[model samples]
Target: MVDSTQRIRVGIGGWTFEPWRDNFFPAGLPHTQELHFASRAVTAIEVNGTYYSTQSPKSFARWRDETPDDFVFSLKANRFATNRRVLAEAGDSIQRFVESGLSELGQKLGPLVWQFAPTKQFDPVDFGAFLELLPKAVDGLALRHVLDVRHASFMVPAYLALARRYGCATVFADSDKFPSFADVTGDFVYARLMQSQPDCATGYEAETLARWADVARDWARGATPAGAPLVEPAHDSGAARDVFVYFINGAKERAPAAAQALIARLRTG
Candidate 1:
């Protein structure tokens, strides 16, 4: 059941971190050179800046040029698209966000993260309508979507079912601040780990990294790892799924190191 071809991309939220310079990034690493170096160290990077505002096509192209050939960039969709009162009315905003030169990233573009505010609840009729508005492709490039809904209301089976219907992945959030749930809805898995301890040098301890690596392997093999909060009982369907894991939030300064450590563990195994 294990899909050996399944890719496992371990990365941090963003490359521009002042604390990273002290350890993750080399000394005197120019702001422009940060992406150049970070891309080589991690398999992927999540573009958080795009969440705040729309960027130019030229900027996207430049980022694509800066990263390595195999590298991927997961972008957080603009807040304007998801922060509105009515979710379904965001069709125009969603279309604009997608057409805003994201195609320039080419193969380097990964999933588009639609992160809903924590206050947002799971309204099936309304939420389903919003999910329907997400385009399957932009500029002839297939788009993979990941829903990062934080409310406890999303822990319901109906939410995961809706994601499955749209072929969109529901985020596996590993955090205390938000409900930590891991359910595989689509062909791929998107996870955000936010429990890294600030005192720990590597954000997460070695044992924790090993545990996460095992979980990733299980996910790649299309089997839910034991003990993960599940919407339904876990079973092995013998179908493989691609997995993307990001070390984010909590103890933010050490996220890069945590990702690198996890990558190394996966590589050795």
Candidate 2:
């Protein structure tokens, strides 16, 4: 059973970007203050920008210093690593990218996410080789490896088995095209509630948040009844107390507000 004492570490995707604010101040806040203010309320954050470009060690050091020691940062591995025009050609780039990000983030780094493009198909043999290379690629990095595969064909049982062998968690995405939480497998699950509107790709509603919280509570309690597939329990009492919910569906203006409301519900429950 899930321990009751754990506190769910909740976080949002990156900081807010306001065009109006950009117009007012050409330059963004200094790295130290920017991270400090952005992380004031949230205990964790997913570093999406890292997926596109490499960050300087100085910038990462500033980020490490600005946040509280307890805060965790989940970084997306660079796109070139996950989406290769030629798998063989991507080897050097992937190694360099992971090393650079880990070196910069230091102790604050949480998980390293590999988000594969939706167009990519699942090829067991090729994927198996790739998975074999992953552990060695990021050998010294102390971070969880998460796979976010958006293709419908990639959810096969064989793929899941490979993921299990590698100790990688599959991402649970609530979207029109992707499979729901019930279809995925992993010890450490990464769930993204992409929307509330039945048809919309973005924006989550109140009902959706409540439903997710219910699932999270069940996960924390480690109470999967008979006839159910076993999900990885929340790490421990400390890690299971609360669920980590990110507001990716809401508009830039509404995400923070939505996050606030969801946090309140978790606290009250």
Each prediction's RMSD to truth: 1.5, 5.1
What lDDT would each prediction earn against the true structure? Answer: 0.90, 0.62
Clashes of 1: 0
Query: How far does residue 50 in candidate 2 sit from its true spot (Å)?
Result: 1.0
TM-score of each: 0.97, 0.78
For this target, which candidate reaches the highest TM-score against the unseen true structure? 1
Q: Show how many residue pairs clash in every candidate, following the order shown.
A: 0, 7
After superposing candidate 2 on the true structure, give the runs of residues whose Cα lies further than 4 Å from its correct spot: 1-7, 19-32, 85-89, 136-141, 196-203, 223-243
Collision pairs in model 1: none
lDDT of 1 by residue, 147-251 (tens): 999899888888888998999988888988897788788888899999989899889999989999999998887888889998777646767777899999998
Model 1, which residues run further than 4 Å from truth? 1-6
